[model samples]
Target: MFLKFLTFTIAIGGSALGGPIDPFGSSAARVLTQLPEKTWLESIAVRRNGDILATSLFYSSNIFTVTQPSVHAHNTAKILASVPEVNSLLGITEVPGSYDEEAFFFVGGNFTSLTTFSTTVGSFKGFKLTFPRNGNPTVQKVSDLAPFSSFPNSVTAIPQAPGSVLVADSFVGAIGRLDLLTGQYDPRAFAFDDMAVPKGAKLPIGISAMRMKGSYLYYGNPSTQSIYKVKVDSKGYLVKGAQPSLVANISSVAPGLDDFIFDPQGNILLATNSPENAIVHVDVRTGRSKRIIGGPTDPLMPDSTCLAFGRGILDTNTFYVSTGRNISDPTTSARIVAVDASLLNYY
Candidate 1:
């Protein structure tokens, strides 16, 4: 386990020293909407009706909705609902078999500050939110992930495992299983040695982003600047004897990857946060990564955090990304930018 971590660290360190490569420049994307200055938009999930649901990273743990993402001029965001008592919100994903197709699960906790990574341990929780066509939306506490998880950052639904979703516990370097039906959680559902963070690290975040594709579960670790996947069973547990395989070490392309999404063709679009605010397009077959939009100093996408594909026919080819504060200039508004996926043809 130590050998694997050291090997990846060396590979990433070498590539990071080579500096970043930005091919698309700043014209490939445009800001769809933005929140007031100092508001940090952390995670984003698109609704079935084409609206974008975004979570606050440092704000009031409020969830906002940006309607008509494809039409920027007509775009405007309004506070949808705020999780009661929680100080910050992190990861959120839609639950497949819910009423009106508007049900979602999110993670939130009390954080002293994201800049300091000071989390109020044992305060993390998993919540379920839903919006009905004929009535108002509601937020409910689903599972308490404390006493085991230190920092739960991202969540993804298991299609084959109903009423269950996997949560990425970043600080603990583990993947947890949360049961929505029973409100029970197993913090070490899929812990691996490769997910460990080195001692006394500055930003000790592990398993930052997670997603499910087919029978495999893919996740990213910024501490290692790499992505990996493992096969899982119908029960949402990692298959016995299944080993995690490396998808890519993206350090050279961006400082570190925060979150990523996959297209139908199995290609990936990843977001880089903080110092290297950019988007990387990865070709899984060739293992090549290219910067598709933004850069370290691009104001349009000030701290790019997460990306999601737009729903429905009119905007299927569009990708909406959420941005936090401009680390270089905190006074700028956090934004949601739209980039045309067709730009991939030029690359």
Candidate 2:
């Protein structure tokens, strides 16, 4: 059975400049494109070359990429290569190399393994990556990678620090970092500690999505319906025994936040919750939030399962978001939409 919830859509009946022109505010968002039929679209990453990469658990084990024109418009996506027949492929990243080239890499949790694609080989069963695109991307097994049997939920490449990657180990309530060169876990990297909740209170939940800003690491808690920010050291390591501060409380809106992404300006944060099947935005500086998209308010919109920040081809102020047909759906039929970031100004 599909769980129903409330959502606030951009009120179109109001005056353009007087009333709420858009729920999000900036006039930067609009529905740009919809994904192909599938079931569970999980996480997305973009390459410096402007290629969009995405992974789907409900679909086959593969990495998909889409190329768009200089303008922010919808374009068809093509499957670059199928991930090895591993248990489950969860996240992908574009690692840059010398002379402005990049190597595409992906990590999976169920199998507790990391794999890199080769242009020469159709598929490489291990973690080693070889450059100089000859044929299909080549892959080799690397040593010293962190192994978490409980399963990792998400993997992200920090744009500010190239070669430094982070993985959210959901079951362990921790985030781990992998060194690109040695393919080994960096013990000095930052992560949350003292995460255990008080006797009567619930523990700080596992992180579903994370973004780095200056010396702080911002993360979303899917289980607790909260967003937190923690201070980190110079090496991008979390300060030892550091306690996370609540940036925004979402328990009132939804009990579970599936994912979240930051807007271009970094002033706004958008999140999607499963129970409510809605998207909400918050002002990072003030911790104030408002319903900007999804919910029972719009009959045409489906339950939102996941979301990410995408720039529209035409407008720099425009940001795009993608939603899965159902968080529980076993296939990849999902929708991608654009919304004006300026709408946040109304709130």
Candidate 3:
């Protein structure tokens, strides 16, 4: 039964723009694996062990893990558990805590909080799955952030504050904090509209994805199709110098960029549903951007949703892209792609 979900696909050799160029040396872009047509790969995180944990976009109900994929075979797929069927699950991130290793995922729709069982009232919520290094993994409700969010999307663990994570909501247009230990969230802390935003297509959903760099927490604003960064203190509080500022915009880069990952060099790359790029790199320092894949070079990577760097020394310099294009027929072309960053001048 499980084997049916596994798709042994082709070794894709293409790019996202211009002509076919080797983005990953020998393999520019290959279809590593495929998901169900109705489902979409949303957010991804590289585990300490080099594995990947991913969440679904639209209506995919399962959270799964994938080992490093290769041309020799497809991604080894395994569904850890099934979430609510309401298509609430959106953003996901891994928490590498000393006491416990786990993955936290968000779900927002009619649900009020993150619960393993059904409830009469529904809203914004999320789950916490603890995967013990030596024992079996367990998935449970982390918190219901309805009071703090209208539609929660992505979440990032606060390294300085144990059992605490920063969460952003699309519809509410605010950022809040989720206390993992108590399964609750503080009042919404920041608002996007308060900042000076540039003119562009606002993805109705507002802010979606986020990541941390030293003492700063960077998040993606789907509304303006731009990335922004703010400073936070050691305890995850917004410092006095912390002001929401634009990092870069996707107005000219792609139709719109979704979840992005940081290259080892501190530069950033984003995924898009537009034909302009499946993967585009942005120099955070200068705010200059370049397309690594997607314009006419590789049609195979339409609607690239999320991306993450390969963990560990074995897959260093390797970046993986997850695509779920053709929303009309999502599964037929949805795939996980790889780009070799081993040979690049990011600095």
Candidate 4:
């Protein structure tokens, strides 16, 4: 096996198993690139070749790719696509092709717009994205936001469903399914949750990140800072209007939870905002959590916001995290970085 990096940090939080993790590895973490001009690196999608197609709030109509190390910024990452008439690209999930050809898609919202402030009632649109192997990427509108959808935040592609995707509405508190093959839309595939207005924020904050497990759909929200799972049908689709039940309560571990992915062993690999730069490993069966990477515990890296498991053959155990203080002010340390997660996977 091979490895690369900056620094690796791990701290078990809940379970009392397997001695403390080591933080002595050579830095396998590599910063994708620097953030300049407030470009909010929003979401990431791993290409088959291991490159990442990243979207943003500021560069709404553009999707950039983080490629090989280069002597200049333009060479390292340049415009991969210039989507037409799109605003604020965020949630992105790759839709498997029906035949030999595959396609990817993204969700667009008005979150970064000034006119949509204070209200959680805005709608979004979904697009079918094509990243040509020999050329740049392209975008095509596949479905408009369903009436029940309000600010779609996360889009996850369902492998079982041929070209099907589920989009999470952050404020409306629901998950909708879009059939890319037929342009069919189910506005309410599953009932995600929304919390009573937190003491500080407006509106009932709802689901943040979503991913599919074996016959179940798992997601996280502000409600008690817990992650919930719901049953899905044989086709890996959730019943419309069905509610998800709680699986793990990790409030004590990572209070400000964000996006997450599944590890090889079926563990929950998630990011947190309160700790700001942490990746927590949660045991759903035992309801335990361990901060595997980042925190005040690590002086080198700060808290991260977004999380995506690497999709390339060589990088399955790797994960990409977006580390920044906030949306508006991406710090010097603010960067889209990659981490070799083999330690956490097998630890």
Top candidate (TM-score) = 1
lDDT of 2 by residue, 44-160 (tens): 655554445556553445445555522544454455544444434555555556663456555553332222111111121223232354544444343224433244555556665
Per-residue alpha-carbon lDDT of candidate 4 for residues 48-160, written as tens digits (9 for 90 to 100) = 65666667653444566665322222224455665545556767878876444457888775554422333234446787766555553446777766755666778898877
Question: Cα RMSD (Å) between model 3 and the true structure?
Answer: 8.2
Error in Å for residue 227 of model 2: 1.2
Instruction: Give stretches of model 2 more than 4 Å off.
Output: 1-37, 69-74, 93-99, 111-145, 158-161, 186-205, 296-308, 311-315, 327-332, 343-347
**How much is 235 displaced in model 2, in angstroms?**
2.2
lDDT of 3: 0.63
lDDT accuracy of residue 42 in candidate 1: 89
C-alpha lDDT values of all predictions: 0.78, 0.51, 0.63, 0.64
Tell me model 4's lDDT, rounded to 2 decimals: 0.64
lDDT of 3 at 81: 57
How does residue 276 of candidate 2 score in lDDT? 60
Model with the higher TM-score, candidate 3 or 4: 3
Instruction: State each candidate's clash count.
Output: 0, 45, 17, 12
Q: Which digits, one per residue and each the tens of the lDDT, describe model 3 over residues 1-347?
A: 11112111111221121112222323555555565455556666777777766666545555656665432345644565565534545677776466555555455444333222232234556666666656666566666666535556677777777667778776666788877777666747666573223345333556767788887888887557788898888878888755788888866866676778787678788886555546778889888887766664566676677888887676676777776556545345445666667654445
Residue-level lDDT for 21 in candidate 1: 22
